[model samples]
Target: MKSFSILLAATAASVLPVSAAVAAPAKNIVLVHGAYADGSGWRGVYDILVKDGYHVSIVSQPLTSLTDDIAATQRVLDKQTGPVVLVGHSYGGQIITDAGADPKVKALVYVAALQPDVGESVIGLAKTMELPNGDVEESADGFLSLASDKFVADFAADVPKDLAEFMKASQMPVAAIAFSEKTKVASWRSKPSYGIVATKDLALNANLERWMYKRAGAKITEIDASHVVFISQPRAVADVIEEAARAVK
Candidate 1:
């Protein structure tokens, strides 16, 4: 009976650790891409998170209207069962600012993203910066395209040549009207926010990136890359996101 009791105590000790491990929380990561890009932009980051055992989802924004894009992101946020680390790039930051209001969203990560303030439109923000002339071409049909020549020189110079080319070719035409639409709510105001500033970004000037971070009161991480920080500095961007994920629990 003494030996059996000792074995039973050993079993309980072993089971306690396993039970605690199983009870620990799981992290969920949601990626939102900015204008002129699709959800595929998150391929590298998504793979990294998945390998680390994170539940991940990438939202495909229509790039049509602010309300529509926010609604699309909100739909994805709604499906998450636990705390979520919402990551947004460029224009996507704007989407998260509004869609990230849900109680489930534990943190927000902005990658060289726009952190617009209350009642601010893209036009209002861009007006303060000296964006290259003719960088964005507007069609008679009211769509906007990122000039191919500036794709690498302006937005993605630090990325590999092939990947930059691929990004250029895959650019989606965003409705011109979307830029005029202002954000009604800003989630960064309430949520724990993190910002990745791309120092060499030409599309959104480096100074603007700093401005956004300061305005949003986000914990800032700086990277010496172009506007597409995730493509040029994937690991660094992922690290910031992982930190945000860790903060949830």
Candidate 2:
């Protein structure tokens, strides 16, 4: 009987590794930032992911045009040696919705982002819903940016004032036409998706986030933060990203 027990223990030990392998998280994670912000904003989330053993890459795509942004994301995806969990925030959602179609991408996470379907433009969707704060402005040359005075209140109300001010000072002005360009693909339809809704978001209506995420059939998490949920709630955002990664085969 003792020998039989010892044999059972050995069998359990042998199965442990297979179980672990099956549950292992996806190794590669690519984070995409939206217009008016750069990849630097992903620092909080990136640090958390790296500490948790993820190989994370943040795409700093020039917000020049939809094609350019998508190309930039695809370039990053090409560098990964294995499957990737592609994540996007704000306008970056439109980017991932198109770029996530890459064969190497295993899943997608949208954080307070615009998930536009094929033939749909960000401008088109924004028209369907009214933002709580209309603090954004367009330049004479046709670039779009948030008004400096309203940046903290509109975009990063939950983050520290200093950081929000810096984000405002360093905001990337996306071409106005970028918002008018339509997406050619919607990857969430094919890939497993997770969504985070910032219930206190003012820049983009929180209700719009719920509608888009639900339409895409994304697993959703709602947090009481501003538009920059990834910055204000990095730990929670990382948790959802890791959840998406684990769901990947």
Candidate 3:
């Protein structure tokens, strides 16, 4: 962790201590990534959370359909030893919305992610926002991906150019139809949620990020970063996730 963000987290922790009733925060954390990205992107945030004595797990959700992604997350959830703090980024939000209803899930954290209601979909929710041009590229075989050239600019401008370029080349392919798949459940309705809004995000509207978080009634945090704020601002992101975890301990 960077010195500044460590201090930033400490300051935030001081201002908001854990409640007396929470004997211990949920020890298990499950991280879910969005489209065009994979579980590896969560390494930085994972390290911070682990260092804080939290047992963390990552779900490699295949970007096929909402049901497939939810199934993938459930596999991980089923193995947890205790209640889980379910975290999602971008498109992964809907996955948690569905899987988070699992009895093992205790909390949710959204990192500039989509939060839809029962029967809502990524495409339906996207229609409410002004999406970036060239941010999405559809392959002939039907998989959707991020445009390599625009990735750094739209997805990870806060990240270094070299790392951003590498991420572009290694991008995960999401099924284009995933966006149209509606969620059958919205866990945010039944569970407490924490949200992070990337102020400089271009791929998803910053205003829409605010709107969705507000709609979910989440405790919100804002950062001046692109969509991949988790990579560029891992410490701060981890802090917020930790905050949500601590509340449900």
Candidate 4:
């Protein structure tokens, strides 16, 4: 509670309207982090959305289990006083898919995340498709990690070297088994969906990203960046989230 921060300052470029129509409230935004990253990485997108007069909250996931991450994100959603645009990055796709089932969630935005449907899992999807994290190293205790040496090239290829290095140093370690847990529901199935597909992404297969989006019937936008497109390309990411906000009805 005390650890969570609410970003209210405006900084990033504002979003354009989709159309003039009666829609749900787009005042709240909740961002969920994926594995090998944390909420701090959402600073850029947070600034953009907050500046546009949206109340933005970044969920600090425990990265220990799927249930824990979803619970943490839901807790953040619970604090919002109005409809929320739930956005997730990387493994956070799974988190939002689970947490976004809440009635307060108006829509969903996936940024280079693993969008697993009901009865599917993170590892299950990756196992069927080719992922870009070939250099990721798992520990003996079941926590999965990315090598700091290869983290920059594999996860944040377009990001500056210094920032990528800092991300590697502070990245969260996710429980390897979390990837194997099946999703009970995919909120995108019942909610409006938007996606940011990273063309240069190496951690996730671009085709798989598109496949998931297409299946979910998401409003898709492609960006030429790496896995951490939220950092390398915050504008596009924020724009899609805003679009999701606008799509609410």
Best by TM-score: 2
Per-prediction count of colliding residue pairs?
Answer: 0, 0, 2, 3
Local distance difference test scores for all models: 0.86, 0.93, 0.90, 0.86
Q: Which residue pairs does candidate 1 place in steric collision?
A: none
Task: Kindly list the per-residue Cα lDDT of model 1 for residues 1-249, writing each as its tens digit.
Answer: 999999999999999988865455548899999888899878888888888888999999899888889989989988998788998998888888888888888789999988888899888888888664458988899988889887778877888899889989999888878888998888888888999988878888778878889888899999988888897777888889998887765
Tell me which of candidates 2 and 3 scores higher on lDDT: 2
| TM-scores for every predicted model | 0.88, 0.91, 0.90, 0.89
Off by over 4 Å in 2: 1-24
Worst 10-residue stretch by lDDT in candidate 3?
A: 15-24
lDDT of 4 by residue, 151-236 (tens): 88888889898898899898788998889889998889889898889999888899999999999999889998899999988888
Task: Please write out the lDDT profile of model 2 over residues 92-204, one tens digit for every residue.
Answer: 99999999999989899999999888999998999899878888899999999999889999899999989988999999999988899999989998888998999999999
lDDT for position 239 in model 4: 85
Write the candidate numbers in order of decreasing TM-score.
2, 3, 4, 1
Query: Which residues of candidate 3, in runs, are more than 4 Å off?
Result: 1-22
Off by over 4 Å in 1: 1-26, 132-134
Q: lDDT: which candidate is best? A: 2
Superposed Cα deviation of residue 151, candidate 1 (Å): 1.5
Return the lDDT, model 3, position 198: 94
Better of 2 and 3 by TM-score: 2
lDDT of the structure predicted as candidate 2: 0.93
- What TM-score number comes out for model 2? 0.91
